[model samples]
Target chain A: MKAKKSGGNSLFSVTAILLILLVWQIVCSAGLVSPYLLPSPVDVVKAFISDLPLLIQNARITLIEAFVGLGLGIVIGFVFAMMMDRFEPLYKAFYPLIVLTQTIPTVAIAPLLVLWFGYEMTPKVLLIILATFFPIAVSMLDGFRSADRDTIRLLESMGASGWQIFRHVKFPGALPQFFASLRISVSYAIVTAVVAEWLGGFGGLGVYMTRVRKSFSFDKMFAVIFLISALSLLLMKLVEVIQKACMPWTKTQ
Target chain B: MADLSIRDVSFSYGETQILKDVSLHLKDQELVSLLGESGGGKTTLFHVIAGVLRPDRGQVLLNGQDITGESGHVSYMLQKDLLLPYRTIIDNVCLPLLLAGMKKKEARAKAAPNFADFGLAGTELQYPHQLSGGMRQRAALLRTYMFSLSREGSPVAALLDEPFSALDTLTRQEMHRWYLGMMEKIRLSTLFITHDIDEAILLSDRICLLTGRPGTISEEIVIERPKSKRDGFAVTEEFLEYKKRILKGLKRT
Candidate 1:
């Protein structure tokens, strides 16, 4: 049943993509643009299939970087939210720092990280972490801080200790927001890993693109691009599933 | 008898005084409902009495012992039910017990008996959102009363501030009746704050009427045989007479 459902979904998306391809192919055939700049859908799919194994390999590398960085980013974000909750001065001082970090683009910082850590996984992971941290921190902070004030007051009246209030009220309230942030951050985490890999790397989809470009294999490049998109969609769907699982109350009736 | 007394209590936000030389007392297991309009400082007084806020000047005496600025001695119910939406009803109720260093298993076991008293037995595993307003209020009350600083004993007192304001008229009346029944069954002192004079009279052994933007007790009236009071009978001549007096006191401001 699950496979049937997923196959039906894939068919729907595939149909939608074929329609877009039809439009693109018509536009290109009408000499709207050169083939070099906008490859036809057939050429792209042909390129993609031939280089599937290589694309898959690079994707594995990018996925590792993204997932690892995401784990670190989530941990850091949660701890930062906790610190902000524990002390007012810390919240005031650190909130601005978080915003500052987000403004400094990971693309801008990627090269610097490569220089510092060399052309290793460290730079890619660092870039991904930097890119993904802010949303989770900001969302979780706001969620944790705004946790039903009335509930906290009621808990206080119930003789709840500070830690008890956090454990029972604030922490639970922050989950939905945290999951939302995780969803956003996951995409950013993957894209960041790809971007960092592009700067200079031996492996990852970035490197695969580089190889395809050098050989002028437009089809394989398009295939790699398709795979990357698929990967992102998969990650996003996973996060959505996790979110629903964690917050069972939010499931639609 | 556990009585609470506020002696010459005073408070100010910067130079603007809230309460000045105010005094009120509630005998053991007595319920005193406070009647006032918005910005009347009734809530501030309630906060001070509950030890959530410190009075600029005064002594909050529990059983004639100074507990001013102390914590965890009184239970409070704010305007909303403030149940942790993520937690099961039983977990929310067991919060105070866990805070007071009770083992989770033991605290939960302790809360089991009072679950049915508040008419929240089978719904213990339900999230707060699943329960109706009246049900949530009952669960909140049960949570408050099931845990005390004395390590999971019954609550000493409850401070209810417009706790039924969000409920419909019928539910509000039902909750008021339930509240009275709950208090009598538990024999806990209660300080109820409400802008509705009828509600104040309905739940209180005595009603203290306050006036002023920076409030003060402008009038006080005692309702004898309060435990035997009828619900939805606020339109009775006796109830109407008290409400009229409170309105008059309020108009003087």
Candidate 2:
């Protein structure tokens, strides 16, 4: 019954999106906004088809950076979370600083990263890592903290050591939350990679967007926007699939 | 000597006494229930016995060894199934062995044969979410059994904390029957905690009634029915006699 309700809601969402698209096309065709400023749906579609090869090539660079950054972010998050969880003093001292890191706009750091690492893949990857790791680390820390007290007690009764408690109880308990944060971080990775590339990069979708915008190719710019949306959605879906595959017990629960 | 004994164990959190001079014992292959009201220190006693919490006074003994504040002497199952959602059912069951420094293949091999005994055969590779509530509990019980098995010497005793309270009424009844049957074969010295009087009567060879603000066992009532005659025993005069005595005991608290 609940599943059917959610299914209906999603169908309604799809219709709402299609309706918005139709309204957008109508307004563009009616010349409510200048074609240069807001391309029609048809024009955007045509531009997408024409620029497909270039877009795919540039997107590949951005995607690679995103993946590398995501991997690095996960490792950093896992280690940092473990450290914070293991040491109360570390957690108390660093928790506020960790939250503070998220307050600064990631875009503000892009230029500094570019200056230090140059217009190479390194800066873009680092920017993405900086952008995405916060969610992973915070969520994982929360997960570790929120492990069921009863289960931990169970492990302790079995004569489990501190390390054994973590292996058998804390780590597994934190996984669902870790996967939830992964979905957010995966999407953040792609967006941060693009934002970083825009500040400075040799080749990527963001660099391509800057070039197209300078030439007043709004349709191509819109196409890149749509492609980025698609890519983010795709990455989020991939994470969901992997989470389901790995945590099958979550499905029944 | 009893397989497990708690000699005048008392515990407190700062000023609040959770358990006061609580002494209890379980002989070899015996199953006993600790019956009490909510917040009556049943769990505190479990924690103390499990060595997750050190008592303010007294000792926790396994096979006459004073193991107060030491862990891994007994297996414990919490109220929730507490299955690690990320691992396959078999892997969850094999966790204790893994924690004991057994190799994955060897641990899995040991856990494999008992799936049939636990009535969870063919779910070896399945995730926790794929199983029903009763099945999840079965898997948890299997995990608890494995934790005890991994230890050397006498059969591993189990400490279960209201292991069926989450289940629906019908499922709870069904599990009671299944659990009693399994106990006959496995024969682990067991300490079962429950607020449910019927449940305590149904599963325990003896029910230890815990009462008062800082709880201790007020009375111990033995159930004499053989395993074969336990079915439909709940409606019998003998069952009501025990229930009336227990209710009177609770009133005294």
List of clashing residue pairs for candidate 1? A47-A219, A47-A220, A48-A219, A48-A223
Candidate DockQ scores, in order? 0.49, 0.56
Runs in model 1 deviating more than 4 A are A1-15, A24-43, B148-155, B211-214, B229-253
Clashing pairs in 2: A158-B72, A159-B71, A159-B72, A249-B128, A249-B129, A252-B129
Report residue A89 deviation for candidate 2 (angstroms).
1.7
Find the 10 residues in a row with the least total lDDT in model 1 chain B: B147-156
Clashes of 2: 6
**Per-residue accuracy of model 2 over A215-236 as CA lDDT, tens digit each:** 9999999999999999999989
Candidate 1: tens digits of C-alpha lDDT, residues A27-53: 878889888777888778777777678
Candidate 1 residue-wise lDDT, B86-176, digit = tens: 6788888887777777898887888888888888879878888889888998887776676543433333666778888988999988887
**Candidate 2 at residue A96, lDDT?**
93
